[model samples]
Target: MRDNIILACQTCKHRNYTSTKNKKTLPQKLELKKYCPFCREHTLHKETK
Candidate 1:
């Protein structure tokens, strides 16, 4: 099943995005490059509780 997760900006430490992933297929935390309005640039986003 798909599980909800929060994506936090690495630079500004802002929780800017929310997404889901297949828990069975990928067990590791998700990391992505996404836009952060607070930082006003694209930054590395890491998964958090």
Candidate 2:
């Protein structure tokens, strides 16, 4: 099943995005390069618990 997760900016520790993932298929956390308004740049966003 798919689970909802929050993505936070690695550089500024700001919660910027939300997404869903399949926990059965992928066990590891999700990471992506996304735009952060707080930082005013594209930064690495990691899944937050």
Q: What is the C-alpha lDDT profile of model 1 across 1-49, one tens digit per residue?
A: 8999999999999999999999899999999999999999999999999
Q: Could you say which candidate leads in TM-score?
A: 2
lDDT (Cα, tens digit) per residue for candidate 2, span 1-49? 8999999999999999999999999899999999999999999999999
The C-alpha lDDT values of all candidates are: 0.96, 0.98
Q: Note each model's CA RMSD in angstroms.
A: 0.6, 0.4
Model 1 — TM-score against the truth?
0.94
TM-score per candidate, chains pooled: 0.94, 0.97
List clashing residue pairs in candidate 2. none
